[model samples]
Target chain A: MQQVIQANLKDNDNIEPVFSHFETQLNGERSSAWHQKRKAALEELKSLTYPTTKNEEWKYTNIAKVLANDYAFNAPSDLTKEEISKFSLSELEAHKLVFVNGIFREEFSDYSSEKGLHILSLKAAYQAHADLIEAHFSEIASTKEEPFTALSTAFAFNGVFILAEKSAVASKPIFILNITDTSDYPVIAQPRNLVIARENSEVTVIEDFVSVGGKPAFLNYVSEFKVEQSAKVDHYKLQNKGDNNFYIGTTQVHQSDKSNYNNTVATLGGGLIRNNLNILLDGEYCEAFMNGLYMLKDKDHVDNHTMVDHLKPNSYSNEMYKGIMDGHSTGVFNGKIYVRQYAQKTNAFQENKNILLSENATVDTKPQLEIWADDVKCSHGATTGALDEEPLFYLRSRGIGEDKARALLMNAFAEDVISRIKSETFKSHIETLISNRLENR
Target chain B: MLEIKNLHASVEDKKILNGISLKVNAGEVHAIMGPNGSGKSTLASVLAGKEDFEVEEGEALYNGQDLLDMSPEDRAREGIFLAFQYPVEIPGVSNTNFLKTAINEIRKYKGEEPLDAVAFLKKMKEKMKLVNIDQSLMSRSLNEGFSGGEKKRNEIFHMAMLEPKLAILDETDSGLDIDALRIVANGVNALKSPDNATIVVTHYQRLLDYIVPDFVHVLYKGRIVKSGTKELALELEDKGYDWIKKEVEEGVI
Candidate 1:
């Protein structure tokens, strides 16, 4: 064990620039209490090695290609509305926070503030909403266990901050648009976010990662949420980047008593993408729902790691993730459900289903459940198969063409996960994107 | 409309259809009665171009073209329909969507324009009445969670929409109740014309009572041993299959 840890530490030499960038190049509030935390976080990040397939959590994904690139931190750029307008779901009147690179863009954002909802940039929120920022920022989502979260914490610059007041409900959805236009050299971005829904509050927040100009860029993002008692939060992460982009994102949620945390993650772009979704049901009677879909083609690699931690009694969690892999692409899903000893009568279910549409396409899925509570009802299932032949032959036996038949079956398989979303607008938005992806495949 | 000569086929080296010869012109209804493991369904599956069966040696001519050379979809477009014994359940594709796509695809293969949604639904409503299918079932996923009777009725509904030149009912009456059986037979009788033919494969003569056949052939051990009029069905029904089995064993036709 000692030798393994030592060897892993040795691999950190490849990520030397990451540490040096935080120490010498990072330009944020230098004198604030959070800056000292960032400095300590950078030093902590230096002791660990880069994650690789040897690690149990990353066995099916290889980070050699992403780590081998010469990635450097880039300064923020002012983005025009026309340049980023293609990605905005302009039909909805909601709270908007637009970010380019890692800096918040305020000119292209607006929301009605009549419903006791607070929105601000993380850097500005540190000075304005100091109590809320200090209470929840980095409080729930830890960087100790995850190397990507450690990197994002060490180099945190700019992101969004949202807080829904006690018993308050947002009039509409909240859109956090994170756009990257790496028209020049390859760049790396690190953004940190904090979201808090106070007691009995209800809110919907959508985070979009869009890449313009097909540039080669890397985005490492960490967003943390603290849902208070009886609160309801619907969180979405939509990753649509350029073909050469690399993205590693993590969204961590901490729920209070009787609170609800619902998450839907859709990854439709990027060459190498990994998303870590961790929901910690810390209070009794809390509920969590996770639904995800990843459509990969053309040698792209996507890995989704999800965990629903039931720490208290009477908590319930349901997770379902579906993937469609075509061409020579690869997909990986590792879902874990952990029930603590005190979490009696907890009901947790996790399922991951994948379809490999081509001979070269591949999928690796591991659905795991670790329960210390004897009274818990936990079930985990994983299915990986080629498209069913009976249904395909049945479709082609009619006059439908082979390509259309395959696409139809693939879409149907995807809908098993997509249909679970409760929001109609988001459902149709994801439906259209997934429809185009499946048809193109 | 269809002719097969010396059709010998197998699945994984197990020969099923052995030297089967048959001919049927348009407007004729032929009933094939057989015992179990007699390659009755194999003949139907081979006609539909299912990939599992290997045609060892045979010549099946449909409309002066080689039926075996075309794909399943191409054969359906060329006016060949098989009402499957066990219709597959597709949980996401609606029956209406499948039928519309099938009708439009077959139309495209015939060098004709695809019908708009209104025209397509109009035709669908017309055929729905012919098959006694409800609009609610048409909107649901195709045959998913449907009863056996509903699936058979759905197959006939598909046949009504396609209007094939040769419609092969492979035990379409296997799992249907008396009412479902009547509805299916009524739909077949309504869709029949002088330009289309029907071949009914069955193990019992009960279905033959409703959809009367012009000729009845007894298929024993992959070979047709007897051919007679509709009275042959009644005789076989009364005597049971052992009489035919004993005659075939003794080499007496």
Candidate 2:
């Protein structure tokens, strides 16, 4: 249990390797010790096979489009700080880590270091706190089964590393802005991150993926979170990329006894987006929640896969994801809950619901529960259908037009999850983004 | 004012309203009484342009315009309001916000500007008195967690705000206690004006004691077989409607 789990790589014939552009990286670390670790991650990546629709977990998502086009590597570009101002949430005063083209830009980044609050980029943190980063960096999130995670690990240089010490929280939330702006050719950016929350500490992280130009940018990202005993963490990932961008992300969390983990993934804009999230209840009396909402239009595609493993007894997990699909878009959700043999008295619930707005739009969701313990309670359900016409008719009968009626009904449907958010500032921010997206469609 | 001629309709290819014809003028209250499955509510639904019902052959004129040709929202905007028998509960939508949106949409249809927030709240406060509605109830989601009586009262409150020229109360008196019945009837009476009309559909004569009707018609099967004044309600209550069924069975209309 103290060592990292190992995974061997085998090549599959269906997936064509389009990652030759990532043969080298621009990591600023000159330390010889860290260079050897990066080299080994890339060597492991070469032996692994990429997943395709033929795989059971990737059946609904076809990666032909991603493999068809050629993507360039991270190219050095001259973009002023004002250029990325459009993607910054300036309204919220907090720590900012700006990564442009997968390299940390110090001029556009700023942070306030409160008590026990340590926030810096992975590159800078490795330079200053090498021992702390080496001890915890790849210790939990392994590059074994997921080749994409291995690839990101090989080239990760400009992501965020956050730590909230015992009972210490930053004055505000931390914003990690990963902007991909490569105007010449299609490029790729890998931003790897790690978060550590000490005992009884609480912090929130907002990680955003955005693009500015017409280049077909590909984002291969990985993030690891370690929540110690009695600590709380709220993590949000907002994926709003360009129409030609592709995003593949993996997030791993290790929770201790009496710790709490809340994770939400909101995919507002992306051509092809996939999220793989894994949470492990490493101690008893722990709780974890996973809630996601994806709003897709214009032939886009989004897929979410989550797994929660209970390693100890008396733990709880609740997972729910909803999708609103319009145009010819597609969505996929697969949730799995694993209760170990000795994890008795475990409570786990999972639900996935999708509303298809058009006949051509589609969704495939599977919520599964695997329990080895006899005294545990677990339930899973999945539903995908078009919007109910009765509510549409009722609203129209009250003098609201058909378009506005549809928008209001969708908003109400989203409210079931949006209401769970505690911050009015954050809730209204997402509400306005979603409303504007629906109205323009 | 409204007029119907040979109105026939069906739901899911099953005939419901067969050849119903009636006339209602301004300043008049007409009550249509019938037993269960007698098509009284069907007639009201057809008048309100519910799309679930397919009009086989019918013509309805509201102010000399073809009422059957309008959409449900357009019909509502053109001064034709039908209080639903079972109101729909919409979660996450506040009652006050729904009312405001409805009022503004209806006003926009008539080429009028929307009311400001202050003006809108002022008007809402005045009409809320008609039902004696609590201010707290206005902030909650529409009809969510509401009692049956509260839902019925909210319907009447909506009627008071819309002020339609032709208001159809379909089964509004059902599932109400005597107190709630009196309050709802009083709300209707307070909203009445010389330029508007109402058509009440019910199964019992108990509600008639509160909302007095100028004319009462007996609907058997799908057609109106008999017509009389308010005194007819007493007769129907006295005879228990069996006599009318027997008369209709013998073709003695």
What is candidate 1's TM-score for chain A?
Answer: 0.91
Which segments of candidate 1 are over 4 A away from where they belong?
Answer: A1-29, A76-79, A112-114
Determine which window of 10 residues in candidate 2 chain A has minimal summed lDDT. Answer: A1-10
Chain B TM-score list for all models: 0.98, 0.98
Per residue, candidate 2 scores C-alpha lDDT tens digits across B38-97 of: 899889888887789999997999999999999888888988888888888888888898
Clash pairs for candidate 2 = A72-A186
Task: Please write out the lDDT profile of model 1 over residues A16-99, one tens digit for every residue.
Answer: 554554455335557666766676666677766778889998898887766665554654454578867767887656688888
**Candidate 1 collision pairs:** none
Clashes of each: 0, 1
- Tens digit per residue, CA lDDT, model 2, A97-123: 888877788889888677998988887
- In candidate 1, position A104 carries an lDDT of 72
lDDT of each: 0.84, 0.83
State residue A368's C-alpha deviation in candidate 1, in Å. Answer: 1.1
Task: Point to the candidate with the largest DockQ.
Answer: 1
